[model samples]
Target: MDDDTILVTGATGGLGREVLARARRTGRPVRALTRRAALPDDPGVAWFTGDLTTGASLDAAFAGAGTVIHCASDTRHPKHDIPGFHHLLAAAERGGTRHIVNISIVGVDRIPYGYYRVKLEGERLLAASGTGWTNLRATQFPELLDKAFTVLSRLPVMLVPAGALCQPVDRGEVADRLVELALEAPAGRVPDLAGPVVQRLDRMAAGWLRAAGKRRPVLAVPLPGKLGAGLRAGALTSPARAVGRRTWEQYLAGKASR
Candidate 1:
């Protein structure tokens, strides 16, 4: 219950795990919030069982936490994301949490994707929550793209969105930034973090196929309506804010080595 305690939700996720690792290195009291009842044996980290969607066990999770890195999200069931975030905000408010560092996707407003819309709403809710908050919008992660390609590869060919440009930023780099922002005073909507290069989805899929040693043909199929137009217009990219150092190729190389 230390005032300097930093709580990280969704500690088991790809981005959340990275954030938790970096936060632990700060030598401050770090609490990890997970929905699972079983806790890990990491002595340095205080693990709490909590579900953000239903606000279960959040009081203990947020107790005495001065800063919260709001990394917990339900991308699979985005409908639960908003309600979960609402619960998080309420818990933070009750705990007098000074800062809530939220991780959001780039082009949430520009993109017409359902998940992006959910993310945008989360930002709005945090801003209106009247608590100290910081939101960092970052581009897609290489892992996400890799997963998408992996699934598509099962169909004999990769059916990537035609003319869709993707900026795959490293999740670890994003985690570093989130931890940095969590330690500092609340700054509303900080500058975006994007990958070093912007490339079309087809090219990115090709790179994935090469890295994964797959022999699937890449097919660029244009999506109809606003989604296609939004992507073709490069709504997912942040050319001016390509602050991320790691590129898709580097990530692929590293993944191949592992």
Candidate 2:
């Protein structure tokens, strides 16, 4: 890892932060690109302020980087994704980057959500970039599930989508995998990474509440559209490949221990 200078975009995000930390532990030169000027000071990381929508700022970010981890994504404002992704790919090409590693969500193809659609489009663009690339599709993170529980606990009765299945994974594990991918040659579209157990959203929520020492009624409401149907059919879960070892329950336990 010390042989190459790796650049990590979205360095402040949950997954990106872990990647940045892991990269630093490798003793390699790590560069981080963010939209903000001020970031936590780290001697191992060189911070560069840049917006993915504008290609001008990325010139300095990509300079002398052999590998680029494209974890930067727009979930809320998806309008900027296509242009931003295109610009990044072009920059990587021009910079002579050896590989591009992307973190994507599992079941993106089955879900019709706008964000997932944008992610699929990004994947397509990267595939056509002619540069070596690897796309990793992972399940929802445990932290997201924990956040959902916090919101649902506020209600007297939590309303959850019936038949919705999820295999939430650990963000740390996913970050480790991303770093490993960044170091290796691009193996286009690697195997999906997911949690060990397939659980209903309601059940997971209930367990989270119980673990947090809260009690709330769980109402399972069936969703009425294609999006709901996709979730209920377990399209978002990877049954053939249960890769991650940490379960939601184990994650909760670890949190409690901490």
Candidate 3:
């Protein structure tokens, strides 16, 4: 019930795990909220079973927490995005939570993607919620960019979106920024974080192949609709805010070594 207690949702996810690790380093009370009961035996972290979409066990998860790091999201099941966040906001308000830090993606407003639309609404709901809040939108992660190529590497040729550009940031560093926000005063929608470099998707995918000890030809395919045009025009990137340290090639090289 202390003001120092920090509750983190989606604690098992990529960025959420990093946040928990960093939060543990602070020596403050930390609560990790996840849908599963099975969690590692980390003495420094207290695990709470909960589901953001179903709003189950959130009362106990949010109880006595001053700050709630709302990282739980459903991009694949886009339908759950809005309702899940709504449930979080409601729980935070009722539980008397002080601050809520939300993780969002860049170009949600500009991009016509369905998941992005849901995320945008989540941001809106959080802003209007009766609790303190901070929303941080970041560029795509290096692993996400790697996935497209990983699957395409199976074929003789890698197909990429025509003229699309990506500034893939590192999730580790992003977790750093999120924890920083959680510690500081609630700032609504801070400056976005992007990758150190901006390059075409085809080039990034090709680098993945080289790092994986494979060879494949990259072909750029033109995509239709506003989604394609926005990507081609760099709508998904924050060029001026390219503050991330890791690059796609560096991530790939490190992966290859592992």
Taking every candidate in turn, the Cα RMSD to the unseen true structure, in Å, is 1.0, 1.9, 1.0
Candidate 2 structure quality by residue, lDDT tens digits, 198-252: 9999998888877888878899999989999999999889987788988899998
Top-scoring candidate (lDDT):
1
Candidate 2, residue 30: lDDT: 91
lDDT of candidates 1 onward, in order: 0.92, 0.88, 0.89
Q: List, residue by residue over 95-116, the lDDT tens digit for candidate 3.
A: 8899999999999999999899
In the range 1-258, model 1's lDDT, one tens digit per residue, is: 577899999998889899999999999999999988788899989999999999888998897899999899888999999999899999998887999999999889998888999999999999999999999999999889888888899998789899999998999999999999998999999999999999999998998889898898899998999989989999999999999999899999998898
Deviation (Å) of 78 in candidate 1: 0.8
TM-score per model over all chains: 0.98, 0.95, 0.97
Residue ranges of candidate 3 with Cα displaced over 4 Å: none
Total clashing pairs in model 1 = 0
lDDT of 2 at 213: 82
Q: On lDDT, who's better, 1 or 3? A: 1
